[model samples]
Target: VLTGFASRYAEPESQTITIVKDNLKAVPARDFNLGIEYGAVYTIKRPDSWEIIYNGTIVNSLHEPVPVKNLTLYFEDFDEFVEIATIDTDENSNFYFNYTKYGNIEQNPLVRIMYKGDGLYNPLDHIEYGGIEMGADQNWWFYDEDGDGWPEWPFTLYDLFAALQIESSPTTSDLSVYLAWMAEFNENSGTSTFDIVSNLEGLLKGNTSWTSGRRDSGLLFDGDGIITPPQSTGFVKSVQYKELVFSTSDVTKSIALDVGTNISNTIPFVTIKENVGDDWDDIMVDVYFTDSPATVYAQRSTSGATITVSIFIVEFDDVKVKVQSGTFSNTGTFAEETISQINTSKAIPMAYYKASGGDDDWDASMVTTDFTDTTTIRMERHGSSGTMSGHYYVFEAQDSEFSVQKAVLSMSSSQGYDTASINSVNMSKSFIVSSYESDRANDDPEDGALDVFLNSATEVRAERHSETSYFNGFPTINVFVITFTGAESVQRGDFTWANSDTFKETDITAVDLGSSMIKSGNMYGIMQSDGTGSSDVKSAFVQHEFVDTDTIRLERYTNNEDGKGHWEVIEWELMSSSPAVYEDFDYLLWNDILDNVFGNTSNQFVVTSWIYPTALTSNQSSNNVKNVFFSKDGMIEIGINESGYLELFLSTDLVQTTARYGIEGLIQTNEFTYIAIRYNESDVDIFIDDFWYRSAVGSIGEPWSGSVNITSGGDLIIGAELIKYSSFTGKLDDIS
Candidate 1:
């Protein structure tokens, strides 16, 4: 019977068996069968009960079927089986359970299966067999247990009780004790057992810190479990670093940055630190980006001493820039891009034209390309043929359109007679001409001629003439004519001169002939006639004096026919003369006498003269005042006194001996002397040649009670006082 039992129970049996495939498919098939036989007491052996069969190879952790052995399996059904089955896997790690006592097991019943580890296998509890239905709630259950909502297929014991739920026997007490231990173990393990699971969940949920061993399994992290990588905002996608330096001086400086070719926004952070001997006062630093002429990130006006500036540029997309530049030349064609890259179609090609060296007399014109095609521009010197070459700058216009209008001035010359014609557009013009002629013969019949003409369609003309004419013949006839073309013009003889034997006109008026001529003494010669055989030889002298406005006195003296041909006054009369001549003099002399001009003698008196003394009187008495100017009573005198010195004196009550001031040491001979005497009530001052010579302080009494007399009636002599006493023997001028 034992042999028969052995034959039936030799193979392990179980209600259910699970074969774990550790990520392997090429595994040999294995079978585990349990056979049990009763040897005593019972005459018949019960058939193997509750047989569980697993006919597959054991797999590795990857679930692939791998060739491994001694894999223990524990099978239990808490709701159905009163006994549990435990078996060891074969070389293939496959098992079977066969129990004759129990027929086919019910479906959907609670069960537990534990994998007892072997040399190649790590032990694990896989519970919940047939009766454990996968529900939506179970999805959440796995997520709660492992903090990852992903389902694990082929449920294990850990899924049900958080621990291995294998029992030695399928009994209520065993299951209770196992569950209690599992609960205690779960309490002890805390959340650490699901750390790997949580990490995997974090990887799928986009968490930051999930690590294994020494490396991160999910997101990169620091030692403090903080996220290392930047978050995504769907707009800003990246991070970058850049270093920039700006060297600046006292003047404004600019630095260009390499932010990138394409950018939307630019945020620049600048830190400026001044070096030694650097001045930061009133220094400005700015950073920005531009896309004109070229894409440039720039910093402007960072000025100080030696300074270091750090700039952080943040660049993005969606930002735009426009650049504009120009090339200029005065004598050559310049090549430049006239179109803007930012707004190529809207760009306006522009040009500037100016005289090469700032000349305003020449014409200049500016031209631009059509708005539709502004890629290039050509500017050429334009206008009148002689217009000067000009500087030109071509660029994209800042405004919508650009154009220029100009005027031209041209000059040409043609010579015939002595006239010049000028034509100009938008210009005011003027000119002048001069001609000279030699003296002509007295008898020559040719007449001097001058003509002027001016014509203009839109301008007004004015003319002026200055002329002078003279003749060497007597009874000469001269004629002048002028003509005008317009209807408002008056026709008249402009000038005429004639003389005949019957008229015998000896007085003549002067006229302008627009030329320089010779003058005879005080008269401008008009005409002359030579003596003939019938007429006695005659000669005349004419004199003219301008007396007042429009009036002149003329005196003519003719030679008498007494055979001696002596000149005699023939006519003396007054006539009209226009345009009086102006005379200028260099010096004035007092030749006319001043008699009794001073009505009375005062306490103060001054006598002055500029003179050149030539001689001195030898018989003059030293007690008498040899006066240059003497009053009637001898109360005032300006002359040499008793001391033989040039002096000015005032006597009291016409007493000659009471002379108050006899200024001495001022007598000059043969040299021009400026002598002056200033006498006040208390003092006298003498000046020689505009310099102070001597002075005396005292009471000077009033002299002449009557009017002050000078030269007293005898034509008031100048060189001689009263034509007898103290006559000046030298030239005297400017005496007062």
Candidate 2:
């Protein structure tokens, strides 16, 4: 025993020993083993700061390496998704002590800590610990069960370090994460050995939420929700273009809409702004031939003022109408004066027809798979709310035998309808409409069941009216640059060349060096002398430079532990720098997957920038397609840039691209803003806030359809091409 160590009794007796502290009881993450039934006491001093990370070592007494398959991490009795504190363990089977800063409260804020008895988590695991937060309120500040709050006595810093997760990469053996199971037994009881069942790792799987050791399963998470399953809706709408405008999106992570509001929050009819006085606000608008009141997230907003606008409607003599079977109620309103100011040339925008979200039909996806001249791919509509579903009223409508009608519905569901009566609907973009459903199959929700939601009819309708367009015009946001202070520069070591010069949002990480010329003014360039040349570079975009003192490095993460690290440069601008000059030429869609360096389906290389349009708002030239010259890797590729853009770079040399804007309902020459460029395995896709878009498979590389070779790596730059006649020239901002 150490000098100051002492228990309640003069010496700790092997017989049942009772340890008590100021009415407080807590448990630290531990390891229980069936090999040795012994427990050791770990004492920690209460911490001062409100936030603390308690670290320690929970080990199986034998102190030997245990087969990982035999280890199990789970919480108390709640066998399902155990939402317990989960962290990756370290090497040496040691728990590098580190817990959340949250305190254990006055009472015990814990449940059960268990392990597997048979050395496997499959069947069942032994309960190493079992308790909940329940103790006197007086001991709250002094007792730290999680060891994160005010630390207490008997707990030394080394004790905390022992409990932390230590991961090791053995030079000879395969790398692994280790957890040491250590337990103690009381001879007073007949139990001699403790099982490795509950190894302080909560449930391997979790409930609702996600934790490690759960379903990462092999699928890479792009953060963007899958909008469509990549199957066609079996319908197509075509729009010819003279000069297509394109916007580039972050070409990383395969462009999940969940990452951007453009995909996550698209709804029909809602505008981007409350009011615009004169200029026509670029809007993504959805329109229909029929006029009717819509139901959705409804609200009334007003600054206690009213604007006068005349409306014109033609009221037909009471026409025969059916109201829900036998119910009949004639509701009609008189037409008023018409407003002449609103642009009436392009009301309902035409959409470049393709298959995306929407469901319950054999439409596009199936039609592509089983193409038949006679088979008119069916269209489906999830009931009224617009939530998409595999099933549709149109699938129900197809059997009725009206070819044209079926064709029209199929086409409409694929993209949208177009009419010349109005203009500028593409500015609002597309939307997703969906109907919620249930885990079970009951049609209506059970009484007091607490689970009643919409059906699978969620159809995200893009181009909901640009709210600003409703006001007459949209306002252009002013652009400004953030200025840096010299005191900060001095604090940052006088902006020396070796010092990091980037002004990142986090001051703790970024440094400003005064060495390179690029470091002087904007401080934008970052160089790594440690970078690899021809035969030795580990990363396509990184240098080996680091603590070695003489090397400069631009690795994804300062340390390799990030597991998945990425580096990107961002340049934001109100407009693009692409040249405004034009040469008339016929162009079909173009794709390049041949030469660009690509990443896996999980982590991809990305680049994106934006620019305004060439034509004025009043001009009506055929600006259906914006010329785009983009290449993911070293090879050159050309294609049409629209309101939306998506590109994917995959590990293999394959590259993919996806676009939507400027094709269907887009007006001639509206400014294209907010561009993104990205790439990953499986496919690539792009988006422009409201309507712009793009999509392509990663396997198709540069000189698309001509090469199936694996893609490698290369640098990326805009406004100019790495080679040849294809390149972009436009105004840009936020260039990193």
List model 2 lDDT by residue over 1-736, tens digit each.
3457763546555877764321111124454311111122221224542222323233443444322222323332234424345433356433332223334332222222233333222332233222211111122223456645333321111122223321221212211112122111111222122212122211111011211211111101111111222322111011110111112221111111112122111111111111111111111111111112211111111121111111011111111110010111111111111211211111111111122232212111111011012222222212222121111111111221111110001112122111111111121111111111112111111100010111112211111111221221111111011111111111111111121321122122332221110010000011111211211111111111112222223322111111111111111111112333322211111123212233222244333333333322211112121233234344323233443233222334443323232243332233434344333333333433332233342333331232243344343222222222232322222111
- Candidate 1 Cα lDDT to native: 0.29
How many residue pairs clash in model 2? 236
Q: How many residue pairs clash in model 1?
A: 71
* Residue-wise C-alpha lDDT for candidate 1, range 1-736, written one tens digit per residue: 2674474435666797777533322122421111111110001112433323322345665655444434333334445534355555555455444323254344333334455555445565444332113211111111222423212221222222222343332233333432211111111211221111111110111111222211112111110112233322211212222334345444333444443433334333332333221111212233334554213232332243343333333332221212333443434222233444323322222222222322111112111222234454444332222222212222221232211111111111111122223333121111111111212222121111121222231221211111212221111111101111111111111111122221122322331211101111101111122222212111111222222322323222222211110111111011122432212111111222223332233444455444455555542323354535322233444555434366444443333342434344455555555455555553445555423434332453333334232222223222333322343444444333
Which has the greatest lDDT?
A: 1
Q: How many residue pairs clash in each candidate?
A: 71, 236
Per-residue lDDT, model 1, residue 306, is 40
CA displacement after TM-score superposition, residue 471 of candidate 2 (Å): 99
Model 2: residue 502 alpha-carbon error in angstroms: 88
For all predicted structures, in order, the TM-scores are: 0.17, 0.16
Model 1 misplacement above 4 A = 1-326, 330-345, 351-355, 365-374, 380-736
